[model samples]
Structures are given as C-alpha cells and as structure tokens.
Target: MSELRKKWITAPLLKLIKKVLPPISETEREAMEAGEVWWDAQLLSGKPDWDQLLSMGPPQLSEEEQAFLDGPVEELCRMVDDWKISFEDRDISPEIWEFLKKERFFGIIIPKEYGGLGFSPTAHGEIVTKVSTRSTCVGVTVMVPNSLGPGELLMAHGTDEQKQYYLPRLADGREIPCFGLTSPEAGSDAAAMVDRGVVCYGDYKGEKTLGMRVDWHKRYITLGPVATVLGLAFKLYDPDHLLGDKEALGITVALVPTDTEGVTIGQRHLPAMQAFQNGPNWGVDVFIPMEWIIGGRENVGRGWYMLMSALAAGRGISLPSLSTGGAKMAARTTGAYARIREQFGIPIGKFEGVQRRLAEIASVAYVLDSAHKTTTRALDAGHKPAVVTAIMKAHATHGLRQAINDAMDIHAGKGIMDGPLNYLGNVYRAVPVAITVEGANILTRSLMIFGQGAIRCHPYLFEEMLAAENPDTKEGVEALDKLLPKHMLFQVKTFIRGVFHGWTGGLFANSPRGVGYAAKYYRQMDRYSAVLTLVTEISLLSLGGGLKRKEQISGRLGDVLSQLYLLSCTLKRFKDDGSPREDRPLLEFAMRAGLHNIEVSLMEVFQNFPRRFLGQLMHFLAMPWGHSIRTASDRQSHACAELLMEPSETRDRLTRGVFLGNPGDGVDLVEQAFNKVCATESLRDKLKKGGIRAFNREAIDAGLERELISGEEAAELREAAEAVNMAIQVDHFDHLGTRES
Candidate 1:
C-alpha cells in the first residue's frame, strides 16, 4: 500500500499544496461535509454505465396530470392573458388569485392524503413552464410556495402534528407560506445570520411553559407581504441551561404565525419591472412553543441540513422550468420574427449574422429543455441529486439568460420596448432574478457544484480521508491498507479508459445501444468522463484538503462535470424523442459545443495547476487525441438556423407549449404573415421585382396594388402589412401627470 502511494506522482505534491494554499473556511468545510453521494457522484467517478442512465426513461405525466394541465392550468393561463397580468402593479389580479387558490395551484407538491394535488415533479415542472410563458410575475407567484417554503420543508422534516395542521391549510390556500432564510446582511452565507431565539418560560395558551422568544430580520422573502405563516430559521440559545448545559444549539427552524404580536408584515419590494409580492418581515421578542421547531426537540440544530435537503428536492424543478419557458419563448418568437420582418428585400433570417443568433436560440432551447426534463425525471425516481440540482439551477438559468439576450438582439429595437405586444421585454428583465436566486449562479458554479461535489461524489476519497483522520493509529493504517490498492487499481483503469477513448475518438466506448450517428457522442462523453475522473483524482491527490480553497480550479472542474451532464441529457433527449433526422443538426451542435467547453475547462485546470510537471503530464495523458478540440462548424450552425427560418411542424413540435401571446403580439402575428406572403412564388417574385424594399405596411400594400400583381395576392399582402406594422410598434406612456394637466 505504501509502495502504491509512492508510485502515485501526486503524493508529494499534496504536501506541497497544503503548505502553499490557504486553509479552508468553516463554511466551505461544512458544505463539503454535508449531503451523501448521489448519481452525479457516480458518473463523475468515470464509471459510465450507459444502460443504467438510459433505463431511467423520459419524464412521464399521468392522464390525470395531463388533464389538469389541459384543463385548470390552461384555464388559468387564459385568465392571465385576459387580465393582462404583466402590466398590473399588483402583479396577479384578485380574481386570478382566487382562481389559483381554488384550483390548488399552491398544492402541486404536497401529498394527496394531506388534501393536496400530490403531483409529481414532472407535472410541477410542466405547470410552471406553461404559466411562465404568459407572465413572469404570475409564474413567480406559483413557483414560490411550491419551492423552498414551509410546504417542502414540512414534508421533509416536519412532525406529524405539524404536517396535519399546516399541510391542509397550505394546500387549500388557508395559509400562504413564506420562508425567512435570507437576511439583508447574510444573503448567500446564511450561516452568518444574526436572528436569534432564546429558550425560557413563556405563556402558551394562558399556561406557563417552556418556549422561545424569537427576534428576526429577514428580507427578499417571496410571498412575504401576504403570508399567513412564516417559516423562520434562527440561531437558538439556552443560556439558562433549560435544554441541558449547552449555551447554543446552532441554527434551528420554526413555524411562526404572522399575526403574532410585534410582528411586521406587508412591506412590498418591487424587483426591477416584476411586481411579485417580495419584501421584508421583522419580529421583536415574539414567543412560540417548543413544538414549533420543524421536527420537534429531536431535530434541533438540524435546520441547515433540513433546508439544504429541501433545496435539493425543489431547486431541480421550479427555476429550471421557468428557464425552459424563457428558452422556448425565445426560440418560437425569434424564429417567426426573423422570417417575417424582412430587410433589404429579403427575410433577415436569411442573413448569415442573424442566422447565427437564431441557431443559438434554437439550440439553447433544445439543450435546456432536455436538461430540465431529464433532471425532473431523476427527481421523480427518488434521487435528491444535490450536486446535479445545483448544476442544473446554475446552468439552466445562465442558458436562459443567453437565449433571451440573443432573442433581444434578433428583435433589435422592438425587444427593448415595454407594452402589451412586447413579449420578450418582461422575460428579459426577469433574467437577473433567476440568476440571483436559488443559491446565486456565481456561488453555485465556483463553490457548490465542484466544491461539495468533489468530496460527496467521489467513491473512495471521503472514506480514505476519514480513515486517515481516525484517532486510532492501527485502525487508520488498516483502513488505508485496504483502500490504497483498490484506489491505485481504479486510477490505472481510468487512465487506460482515457487512452482507449482518446485514441478511438470514443468509437469503441461502452455506450447504450442507440442510433449509429449518436454513438460517437456517447463515446466522446465516456472519454471526457474518464478524463474528469483522472483530473479529479489528481487534483485531490495533488492539492489534498487545500483544493477547497482553490475556487478557480474547483469552478473549472465543475464546468467540465456540468457540460458532461448536459451532453448526456442531450443524447438521451435525442434518443428518447425517436432520433428524428431533421433534429440531427441541433444534436450535433449541442455535442460540439459541450465537447469544446469540456476541452476548454480541462485546459484551464492544467494551466492553473500548482504543480507544473504533473499538470503537463496529466494534460498529455488526457488529451492524447490533441490539445485543440473542434467546435461546431458554421455549416452546422447554418443548418440549425435554416430549421428556424420558417414555421414548420418541427419548429412547433420543438417549442410545443409556449404561449405565443395574442394575435397582434409580434410573435404569432409575424409567423402568420410570413407564412401567408410566402405561400406563392409569384407573390414573392412580384414583390422582389417591384423593388418594394422596406418592411412597413405601406410598401407591401403599394407593391400588391401595382398592375404587376393580381387580386388574390391583395388580402395576403394587406394582412402581412398589418402584422409587420404591429410587430414594429411599441406601447406609449405619458410622463407622470403632465398629460392629465
């Protein structure tokens, strides 16, 4: 075993890393210590068991779930459209709120026996995606209660009595719940919160009993203003020795009624253009029974763990769903607008520059939607997948941000305007909110994904560390004696796998049976997976505990892992959807993009590695194929862009359920007009020959009225003209009260 350790080149480098790198912070250490190994942990370990992943299947929605979506959810969406919820300062209308409460929109995740809808994660994701296409404000309203609130926490860690009392109320809308976790001073570092609760004797139902006096200041609590109940997390103190001799029992979670004395509520916060009911709530020495603690006395000092677990479950569903909605909307609307809104007498979609953006929008929509479905399906299969969820939350939102920006660029001036007809404006403004919430994208990428993932996901690393740290020397040596040989053999296997995959370009890789064209992508994924495993092992061995402080290295490693997962999902989506030939361009584009990103991340890791010699050797071993990996070609981009140039069954199928807004809205109207004017070659030729260059209503009408064109083309020309006119128009607003005066 000692000889095996000596043979590893990174052994001495580990000691060197410990001497040079800063010590790991307590928060970082805690995060690493939290959560058990999940599926992502296994995949990143270089064991690409394709059969097991494929067996999970696509996300399934039951008949009842479909009926609910087509019925009540659909009806609610129509109501939002009719109400024009996007323009309202109050966010959702009272009538719409009542409709949502009556339909039990807030109860999607609660169990049926608890008087709730008991919907699966797939159903939950579908509902959020469909609703988000209509109004972001309304989407946030529906999303908040179902994710990271009392309902989710209660279901996971609540006492039976608490569940019975609170679950039904939450499900039926008798209680609107909001979680008070993020303080103004402690947004991401929740452990730094100053909210405190002291155990003492207090009056409960007119009887003297042991209770807690809690004081809290929390901000950015979604649903805060209207919440009937607050789920509070605060540090608990037992200075009087009321609960044993401990002075502090760490952070604890408790339920507090909003109507309690000295509690302030209903302070609204307007987030950018969004009017969601977000604000601050504070309490001054409010008393609560000991029973209010999430899991009663037995679960004290476990609030952080419970919260992390709840986040693990819900984060994979809500934000990803909303991001999927944004991508789908961008794809559908931008594609149609590009085809219809012509410039230089030709559709802008035909231009190489615009085509590049269009292709990106379409491809982003495909990849993100695939990721959302695959992750939700995994959740439904009963895997919490903490690291996977963090990656999805960060990457999906980032994808949405890029897709919407591309859509805005395609729309040019029209996308920036705010109005009833401007569909992309609201979504554009909502991008920052998604990027900031659910553990902010920056932190998730730089710290959590690879930081926690490296330790939690590795098969033998954590065990080996535990054994090395054991107090009994003989036992510690025995454990290492058993683990070191297997670890050495595993490293050898991974190196060989990497060599085989690199040499063959993944041709001989072990992948599940699939279409012949997709096989190479699977093999490439396998090769990268092996490379990631080797790099991670080398990183752990070279940096030891100090790797936790090397966030740049950790973040790059996360990028490789995340890209692998995204690529895997892309392949799964292609195969699961029947491997259509028309969609091959998109699949190819995603594969190239993912592989290129993996290569870039690996290079960054090697460039920044502390030990130069080991880094160079490892890079050589990993990239035996060559250092430079190829990206998607312009030809591939053009092919994907061509698919989005016109309204086709494939386009509609790809962006299936996005609400394209009303008839006069830019998206739907432009699509209709483009299809109409291009129906006949004579119409196109006459317009081209007549030299009607501009894309306005008058030029199209003038071209049709000329003797060069016939009467049958007149109606199509007029409708196309009107649609173009509406597409370029923006809403007008008066300055303050000047117009009234």
Candidate 2:
C-alpha cells in the first residue's frame, strides 16, 4: 500500500484522541456544528456586517458539468507545454489570443448548448492551472470570462433572452466579456461605490424605452479594452422606485454592449510583465439598454451579491492555477540544475548541504503540485469551497515563491544573471507578481485565510464568543455559558496534567509521538493553544475588537496553523509516488525539517512573547520524536554523514555553518578534520583562545613542520608557517601533521 494510503487510514488515532480531550460546551458545540468559528464570533461581537456577498450558492456542479470539464483540461495542458518558453519572457501577441479564440479556449465554462466547452469548476481549474504552468497570463485570460464575467453572471441570473443572445456568441469568442467590479474607491469596501445607475423611466417623448437607467465608470477591469461585452456594476438608485421600495437596496449587475452610446474604452494597464494582449481594461460612462439588466429588471441593487458569488468562484479558478504553474517551474529548474552543475569534479548535488536544499525544494514543489491537482479534483467533484480556495491561493503562492527563491539560490550567480539559455532565473525575478496579485500578502496574511478561516477552523471560539456577548443567546448561553468559568476550571486541570506529565518526564502523555524523542515541540504546541484559548476568551470579554483583542492570541497561532497545513501538504506530496529506497532521504528530510521549523517557530514565539515561562518551556513541550534533534543525533551516529549536518553551538542558519563547498584534492587527515573544524563553531571558537593562538603558527612550524619534512630537520622549520598551513590545510588537512617524522 502507498504511504499516503497508510496515513489516510489513520482514523483510529484521531478517534482515540477525541475521547481524551475535554468535551466542548453546548454553546461552543453550536459553533462546531456550524463549521465556522471566527466570522460568526464577529457577528456576535456586533460588528457591522460589511460583507456584500451572499450565500455562495452551491459551488460543486452536477455530473453534466463534470462531463464538460474533461476535454478542455487535456487540450490546455498540451497548449501550455507547447508555449512554455514564450510564456517565460512574457512572449505572446494578438495572434495568440486570436488563435485561442479560434480553438475555443475562450469558452470552456460556457454551457454546451451555448456553443462553449460547458466545463465544470474542476475542469476549468485544470485547464487554467496547466496553462498557468507555461504562462499565467493565458490562465488568467481563460479564467476571467468563464468564471466572473458575462458567462457566469448570465448563467446564474440573466434572462432567457440574455443567455440565448450572448452565451453562444461568448462561447465562440465573438463577444469577449469583462466584469467590472473593482475601482479606486471601492476594493474590499464594495458598498462604498459612488458610481450609480439612475432611473429615467418616463420621458415626454413618443419613444419606448423599458428597462432601468445605467451609468458607470470602471477601471482595473480585465478584458476591458478588447472585450465585445461588459458586465457592469453600479449602485441602484430608484427615483421612481423601479427596484423595490428601498432607495438603494443592493448593488446591481448589468450587461452592457461594449459599443453603447455613452461608453468609451480607455488605455490599458499591464502590471505583471505578462502578455500585453490580456491585461487590464478600462471604461467611462458605459451605458446599455434596459434589457441589459441581468435577470431582467428584477435583480437591480443586487450587484454586490451577484459579484461576490462570481468572485468566490473566480478566485478558485485563477490564483491557484498560477501558483501551480510557478511550482512546476521551481521543481523543473532545481531538479534540472541538480542533475547538471558540477564542482570539484563531482556534481555539487553530491554535497550533503546542497542535497538538503534540493530535497526541500523537491518536497515543496511536489506538495504544491499535489495541492493544485487535488484542489482541482475537489472542484471537479462538484463543490466550490470558499475557504479552501482562499487557502490554496495563499499557501500555493507562498510555496511557489519559496521554492523559486531556493531554486534561484541554488543556481547562485547563474540564476541572478540573464543568460542566453532558457532557465528559471528569469521566472525567479517574477516571484513578486503572484504574491502581490489578486490580493496583497499582508491583506491575505492578516485578514483572509486565517482571519476569515479562524471562524471555519476553530472548534469552540465561535459560538462561545457570541454567547458570552449576546442577550439573545441567553437561553443557549445559560445552558452552557460555562465558557469563562470552564476555562478557569480547565487551567487547574491542565496544571495538574502538566505537573504529572512533567514530573514523569513528559513521556507519552499527549500528542502523537511518545516520550523518547517526541516530548519537545508538538506537545508544546498543544500547551500553547490551551493557554491562548483562556486568554482569547478573556480578551473577547474585555476588549471585543479593541486593543487587547489582538494580544489575546498572537499571529503565531495562525502561523502554526499555516505550518501544520503546509507540512501536511508536504507529507502528502512526499508520499504521492510510493515508498522506495530513493525516497527515504527526501521523505525523512522533509518531515524532519518541517518538524524542526515548527518547533523553532514555537520556541521563538515563546521567547519574544510578553508572557514569561520557564526558559526550558520548550523542553516540556517536545515533539513526536524531537525529530530535528533526533535526526542530528542519528546522523552523527553514521560515520558517512556530512560535516555540516551537526547543529551550531552558537546560532542556527539553514546551512548549519558548513560552507557550501567542494573539498579540494590531496587533503591529509589533520588538515581535513582541522578544516572542517574551522567550518564548525566549536573548533572555530576554540582557535580564538589565548593558549591556542599563542602556539598557532610558530609552534606549528617547530613541532608540526618537521612531520612534513624530515623528522630531524622539521624541528628547525618555521612555526609561523604552521599556523597558516593549519588554517589552509584543513580542506587537505591529512596531508600535513601526518608526514614522515
């Protein structure tokens, strides 16, 4: 059986785990049942509901949709591989777009009856990601229309006539569509839009015009200048109350012909160094006929709601696809580089230091690759996941960026310079695009995945936070408001547990790994979470969303969450192919490195945290096997292990003080060990002492030089030269100090 299969079937461990933990209170249980933790808490906090989007209507498609997805995916993969290089330097043209239109690339998500590919989310995701591998510009172009533009909106809310008229033409690329949602004043704050669609229902004219009035100015729109159609959004104003009773009830979605009388296409903006053919589009005072109202005249003032649903689906389509492509480039370059580049007559890959980096890069690349594929499969499974999509967008992009950076480093000078040969160094320069695009990292980092997903991922924080604050939840809270009181009670019990566990050396108390090596990090994470929960509740009481709120729990919690998620991703990738001899190093190294990073991160959080703990707090909160520590110990046991594998006595860095070097030829024993020692902190530090420095060179010439020359004459040799020789000889150390005496 596959390693992943074994891990996949680990149900019994999880069940055993739940039985030992404290049972969630009834109030908190509601949060658990709801599958959200943070946002619900926000609602309970009485924060204004700023979200303009609606119930993301079911994202997963039906079997028919699934059937539609397959063919497009395969074709897209082919196109990507074929156009790989042109994509690197952002090489493409109008001819390419025209060819894409001719090949029906523009219509994958349109309904079949509409003359498009009629593919499902999964299928669309597949095509988009595959193309993104070769060129993300292509992927974005493929994603925009099918996902958030005229095609999705019309399919969801357009009138029968609207779909019949525009769908077929859109599928055939006869009318490319761009959705205008973002503007300078309105980004995350969509309700703040100043642009309005005013009504001019009745005029003293012998003419007939039936629908609601429309006017808009939009920028940063994809497919803007080139599109034959536009889906515009504006605030609904009812002077005659055409859109229900409320003056401005909802944002509205309107289909506007590109050639409308008041509409004017403006200059394009290309920000990402992508193909200019498919970048940003702009327009001013776009006006369309009354029949252009999506879902006819009935759905006015509901544009925000409509756009949200589409954006959610659209995000799942594009960003993840781009990240996947970047990952592929990272793996391709690193693996290719490892196979070639030689130093000291051996491939640099032969060195353990270089090999470790290569392994990590491989591990990350594969993990991201698998995530992209799996997320696509889930999309194919007929379900759209808002949080999952967000997570993918955040994590996958990060992985690609890190992997590419590592790839660039591995290439060193070769990567930094522009070369005649086609390579990933250029791709490395483009790393910021993915990170900055769709959403900025700080926003995504601070608010989106964790800030938003905390609601989805937490077990009790959601409901309890709400119940504690609201009178409406009085009955529910009354039954289980044991929240604050329970936390106090739990801490006492926790102290009791901690005392017993620590007294017993914390062997096999909680967590997955038992005592011997696993008692350091993972268990500490558990401890940290338990402590943070009590503090979080306290903050929820004292400050709601005030100053003390952020301090209740640090971003470290989210960071841990992020690490676990990524490590899980890495492990899954490490296990994808199958267990084999060649894979052992990669798998073990990835797991060990992941565990070490998490543990260290946890330790750092502990150190800088305002809360004080015994300095050895890390010791009590050990890992499953102290994996990093244990790996170092094990490597030490193996004589064949690299000199760089040992931990530094001073500080830690990725390279472990071992220079990324190739040992030169003709090295002697003392020279070799001495050279390695100089590379190491311990020996390096030792050489700095008074006694050591005093004898350093002169003594080396008197005592050591004779060994290199003749036993009798060496004593008469110089001492100053010995120290220099000793320093230089470390790489070839054995050649000196051991000569005939």
Clash counts per candidate, in order, are 0, 40
lDDT of candidate 1 over 22-85, digit per residue (tens): 3444344445555444558757778678876778888899998999999998788777752256
**What's the residue-level lDDT of 721 in candidate 2?**
29
RMSD of each: 3.5, 16.1
Q: Which stretches of candidate 1 lie over 4 Å from their true place?
A: 1-37, 81-88, 473-479, 624-628, 674-682, 689-709, 735-741
Which stretch of 10 consecutive residues in model 1 shows the poorest summed lDDT?
A: 9-18
Residue-by-residue lDDT tens digits, candidate 2, 474-545: 343342334435645654554554344334433433443222232243343333333333333332333343
TM-score of 1: 0.93
lDDT of 2: 0.50
